[model samples]
Target: MNVSVELTFTPLQNEYEPPISAFIKRVRASGFTVLENPLSTQVYGDYDGVMHMLTKEIKNSLSNIDIGLFQMKIVKTDRSSYVADF
Candidate 1:
Protein backbone atom coordinates (compact mmCIF):
# COMPACT_ATOMS: atom_id res chain seq x y z
CA MET A 1 0.00 0.00 0.00
CA ASN A 2 1.06 3.59 -0.60
CA VAL A 3 1.97 5.74 2.35
CA SER A 4 2.99 9.30 3.14
CA VAL A 5 5.99 9.99 5.29
CA GLU A 6 6.90 13.35 6.74
CA LEU A 7 10.52 13.33 7.77
CA THR A 8 12.06 16.25 9.58
CA PHE A 9 15.75 16.24 10.17
CA THR A 10 17.32 18.44 12.78
CA PRO A 11 18.64 21.56 11.15
CA LEU A 12 22.26 21.12 10.48
CA GLN A 13 24.40 24.20 10.31
CA ASN A 14 24.75 25.89 6.91
CA GLU A 15 27.75 23.71 6.37
CA TYR A 16 25.62 20.59 6.36
CA GLU A 17 23.50 21.66 3.43
CA PRO A 18 25.79 19.66 1.24
CA PRO A 19 25.14 16.57 3.30
CA ILE A 20 21.42 17.23 3.11
CA SER A 21 21.70 17.53 -0.63
CA ALA A 22 23.53 14.27 -0.75
CA PHE A 23 20.90 12.69 1.42
CA ILE A 24 18.22 13.92 -0.96
CA LYS A 25 20.07 12.44 -3.87
CA ARG A 26 20.39 9.08 -2.16
CA VAL A 27 16.70 9.06 -1.31
CA ARG A 28 15.77 9.99 -4.84
CA ALA A 29 17.93 7.17 -6.08
CA SER A 30 15.95 4.83 -3.86
CA GLY A 31 12.68 5.94 -5.53
CA PHE A 32 11.52 8.31 -2.79
CA THR A 33 11.38 11.68 -4.44
CA VAL A 34 11.08 14.80 -2.37
CA LEU A 35 7.68 16.41 -2.25
CA GLU A 36 9.00 19.20 -0.04
CA ASN A 37 12.30 20.79 0.85
CA PRO A 38 15.01 18.78 2.56
CA LEU A 39 14.64 20.91 5.66
CA SER A 40 11.28 19.22 6.13
CA THR A 41 11.23 16.62 3.43
CA GLN A 42 7.87 15.13 2.61
CA VAL A 43 8.07 12.00 0.52
CA TYR A 44 5.55 9.67 -1.05
CA GLY A 45 6.12 6.06 -2.07
CA ASP A 46 5.49 2.53 -0.94
CA TYR A 47 5.86 2.00 2.80
CA ASP A 48 8.62 -0.54 2.31
CA GLY A 49 10.33 1.66 -0.22
CA VAL A 50 10.41 4.57 2.18
CA MET A 51 11.43 2.46 5.13
CA HIS A 52 14.27 0.87 3.25
CA MET A 53 15.51 4.17 1.95
CA LEU A 54 15.15 6.01 5.22
CA THR A 55 16.70 3.39 7.47
CA LYS A 56 19.34 2.01 5.18
CA GLU A 57 20.32 4.72 2.76
CA ILE A 58 19.65 8.01 4.55
CA LYS A 59 21.79 7.24 7.57
CA ASN A 60 24.58 5.68 5.59
CA SER A 61 24.74 8.66 3.24
CA LEU A 62 24.91 11.20 6.08
CA SER A 63 27.08 9.30 8.51
CA ASN A 64 30.21 11.18 7.59
CA ILE A 65 28.46 14.52 7.96
CA ASP A 66 27.52 16.12 11.23
CA ILE A 67 23.80 15.58 10.94
CA GLY A 68 21.04 13.75 12.71
CA LEU A 69 17.50 12.82 11.91
CA PHE A 70 15.32 14.42 14.55
CA GLN A 71 11.91 13.14 13.64
CA MET A 72 10.25 10.83 11.18
CA LYS A 73 6.47 10.82 11.16
CA ILE A 74 4.71 8.34 8.91
CA VAL A 75 1.02 8.04 8.12
CA LYS A 76 -0.86 5.78 5.75
CA THR A 77 -3.20 7.24 3.17
CA ASP A 78 -5.81 5.82 0.89
CA ARG A 79 -5.25 8.44 -1.76
CA SER A 80 -2.09 9.83 -3.30
CA SER A 81 -3.19 13.46 -3.25
CA TYR A 82 -2.47 15.14 0.08
CA VAL A 83 -3.60 18.74 -0.58
CA ALA A 84 -7.32 18.01 -0.79
CA ASP A 85 -7.52 16.04 2.44
CA PHE A 86 -4.51 17.23 4.41
Candidate 2:
Protein backbone atom coordinates (compact mmCIF):
# COMPACT_ATOMS: atom_id res chain seq x y z
CA MET A 1 0.00 0.00 0.00
CA ASN A 2 1.04 3.58 -0.55
CA VAL A 3 1.71 5.80 2.47
CA SER A 4 2.07 9.47 3.03
CA VAL A 5 4.15 10.96 5.83
CA GLU A 6 4.09 14.50 7.04
CA LEU A 7 6.77 15.96 9.29
CA THR A 8 7.33 19.31 10.86
CA PHE A 9 10.59 20.53 12.31
CA THR A 10 11.10 23.92 13.86
CA PRO A 11 14.72 24.96 13.78
CA LEU A 12 16.06 26.98 16.66
CA GLN A 13 18.13 29.23 14.48
CA ASN A 14 17.61 31.66 11.65
CA GLU A 15 19.78 29.70 9.24
CA TYR A 16 17.64 26.61 9.49
CA GLU A 17 16.20 26.75 6.00
CA PRO A 18 19.39 25.55 4.28
CA PRO A 19 19.62 22.49 6.47
CA ILE A 20 15.93 21.84 5.99
CA SER A 21 16.41 22.22 2.23
CA ALA A 22 19.38 19.90 2.30
CA PHE A 23 17.41 17.35 4.27
CA ILE A 24 14.57 17.53 1.76
CA LYS A 25 17.02 17.16 -1.09
CA ARG A 26 18.46 14.13 0.58
CA VAL A 27 15.00 12.64 0.83
CA ARG A 28 14.44 13.19 -2.88
CA ALA A 29 17.86 11.75 -3.65
CA SER A 30 16.87 8.65 -1.71
CA GLY A 31 13.96 8.23 -4.15
CA PHE A 32 11.28 9.79 -1.91
CA THR A 33 9.74 13.08 -3.03
CA VAL A 34 8.81 15.84 -0.59
CA LEU A 35 6.68 18.95 -0.39
CA GLU A 36 8.37 21.25 2.07
CA ASN A 37 7.21 24.51 3.54
CA PRO A 38 8.25 26.89 6.29
CA LEU A 39 6.46 24.91 8.99
CA SER A 40 6.29 21.38 7.69
CA THR A 41 7.50 18.81 5.15
CA GLN A 42 5.61 15.93 3.65
CA VAL A 43 6.73 12.87 1.71
CA TYR A 44 4.85 10.22 -0.25
CA GLY A 45 6.07 6.75 -1.15
CA ASP A 46 6.02 3.11 -0.07
CA TYR A 47 5.25 2.62 3.61
CA ASP A 48 8.56 1.19 4.73
CA GLY A 49 10.54 3.43 2.44
CA VAL A 50 8.89 6.57 3.68
CA MET A 51 9.14 5.55 7.33
CA HIS A 52 12.76 4.52 7.10
CA MET A 53 13.83 7.78 5.57
CA LEU A 54 11.67 9.95 7.81
CA THR A 55 12.07 8.37 11.21
CA LYS A 56 15.61 7.15 10.71
CA GLU A 57 17.46 9.24 8.16
CA ILE A 58 15.68 12.53 8.51
CA LYS A 59 15.54 12.47 12.28
CA ASN A 60 19.18 11.46 12.55
CA SER A 61 20.22 14.24 10.20
CA LEU A 62 18.24 16.87 12.04
CA SER A 63 19.48 15.72 15.43
CA ASN A 64 22.64 17.69 15.00
CA ILE A 65 20.71 20.86 14.44
CA ASP A 66 19.26 22.91 17.28
CA ILE A 67 15.66 22.08 16.67
CA GLY A 68 12.81 23.37 18.79
CA LEU A 69 9.77 21.48 17.55
CA PHE A 70 9.39 18.13 15.81
CA GLN A 71 6.29 16.21 14.85
CA MET A 72 5.40 13.47 12.37
CA LYS A 73 2.28 11.85 11.00
CA ILE A 74 1.88 8.87 8.68
CA VAL A 75 -1.30 7.97 6.84
CA LYS A 76 -2.41 5.42 4.27
CA THR A 77 -3.40 6.86 0.94
CA ASP A 78 -6.44 5.54 -0.87
CA ARG A 79 -5.21 6.94 -4.16
CA SER A 80 -1.81 7.11 -5.77
CA SER A 81 -1.62 10.83 -5.49
CA TYR A 82 0.67 13.20 -3.65
CA VAL A 83 -0.68 15.28 -0.80
CA ALA A 84 -0.13 18.42 -2.80
CA ASP A 85 -1.83 16.89 -5.82
CA PHE A 86 -5.15 16.67 -4.06
Which one wins on TM-score? 1
In lDDT terms, how accurate is model 1? 0.67
What tens digits encode model 1's per-residue C-alpha lDDT throughout 35-82? 766357777878887787788766675576665655777778623464
**TM-score of candidate 1 to 2 decimals:** 0.72
Q: Estimate each model's TM-score.
A: 0.72, 0.71
Model 2 agreement with the true structure over 33-73: per-residue lDDT tens digits: 66666777778888877777776766666676876566788
- Model 2 misplaced stretches (Cα beyond 4 Å): 78-86
Question: lDDT score, residue 34, model 1?
Answer: 62
Model 1 ranges with Cα > 4 A deviation: 11-14, 78-80, 84-86
